[model samples]
Target: MFFLIWLVLFLVVVSFLLLLPASWHRAIYERYSGGRPVACPENQQPAVVSIDVRHAAVAVMDGRPNLRLSDCTRWPERSKCNQECLSQAIQAEPYKPGEVKAGRKQIYHLPVLLAAFAAWYVGAIWHSHYMFREQWLQAVGLTHAQVKQIVWWLSPHLLTAGVCLLFAYGVAWLLAVSHRKGVLQGVLMSVLLCGALIATTWFGIARLPHDLFLIEAGYIALASLTVGALVGGLYDRLVLPSQ
Candidate 1:
């Protein structure tokens, strides 16, 4: 009943969110390249393309054709009749005009997301369970009912869900970073995101927590966003073109 309805709603939200990026890419490709000749603005020269031979494996797997230079002053093959076609093709080269694809290589993120989600949840639940059942039960400090009440009121499950969403956002942001990689980028992004979260909170949107616990939760969300951005930046370095 209640659980079933919750599951259904979660599934619906996830499905729609998952489809959004792919649909966005599709719309972008559809609009510009509707079989018309791609025009380079007067100031813009034709493209000069190159690939990294060091990462040849990735390049090969990424399967778009090599771009042909329109000005065949470089290539031995040329014709007066075919210069425009050659020029058009040079523009087309490895990637078709207006058809921007993600990458030849794939590092699946679902497993990473799932693993992080599981690890965080497990840690949080174990902490709550031990606090309520074993630790609090043995201590003269808190009665069993009191321990249960604390855990129930704090709602570890809701906190975990919030952390998970933060994780998702962090990973997505990491893959979207414009520059930098590895620890440097991670550290910087963490700093920026945490700062943003804290600074934004000061604007007086949500009720400020007077307690240490929720202050930590807010920090955790901030950390998650930073980590997510780091992951995303690294992935972009590997999978997307560097700007």
Candidate 2:
């Protein structure tokens, strides 16, 4: 059955997600620490250097006059060192990629609103007479009168928008954590998340009608894609790295 195929695919996706964290860390390490051993600087003890694509930091070191601010915060000793020493030593703070970029106002209103509207729009289209509304109702064993009773007011709309906002927040958090700001990356992440979450719930929990599940799942994936694209595009333009 179609459901069986999706069930198998969901398992594969889950397995892949389970392995991602380890793989991401390994890739980062391999990229930064080449096969060759790193040699310590003359007269300096060996230290761990945390490296990402943009920067690297030594674990600890004595204060030096010529060291740049970016270099200063990267040193591990900066955290434990005396405040006076640190103040005289470094002018700039540590770089936190997820932190709000310097000089750019943090605003959730836009992404939240955008996501809410998009989600509602997609749901409306998916459930309208133009799409699968009747099929979905039949698959779910609900009559048109029942559907009307459920949507006779704004409560459902408000709830839908609220859920959409929460989902947007989750997407934003993931994109922020990964520090990835691209349409493709966002779309990929959204697809992965949407599939994982919805499939897991649909398969693991109580049985759902196949058509009904498919209808709902399709909307979720589409809405997530829309929200992710919006967030990623806006982030690139709105979030500027410190000078």
- Residue 118's lDDT within candidate 2 is 85
Model 1 per-residue lDDT tens digits across residues 1-243: 999999999999999997975565454344322222323333244432222222322232334322222222111111122334434433453545445342222333543365356536544654465433354245335676876776667576667666665654554454343323445554565556656765878666345434433534554664454455445444433332222
Which segments of model 2 are wrong by more than 4 Å?
Answer: 1-108, 203-206, 238-243
- Local accuracy by lDDT, each model: 0.45, 0.58
Regions more than 4 Å wrong, model 1: 1-50, 53-112, 115-119, 122-144, 150-156, 177-183, 203-226, 229-243
Best by lDDT: 2
lDDT of 2 by residue, 1-243 (tens): 999999999999999997875565555444443111122343243222222322222222342112222222213223232223323222233334444332222333465567668888899899987999889988978898888888878899889888888777777777755645567766776777776677678655347777877888788778888988877666545433332
Query: How many steric overlaps are in each model, in order?
Result: 12, 1
Candidate 2 residue 18 Cα shift, in angstroms, is 43
Tell me each candidate's TM-score: 0.36, 0.53
Model 1, CA-based lDDT: 0.45
TM-score of candidate 1 relative to the true fold: 0.36
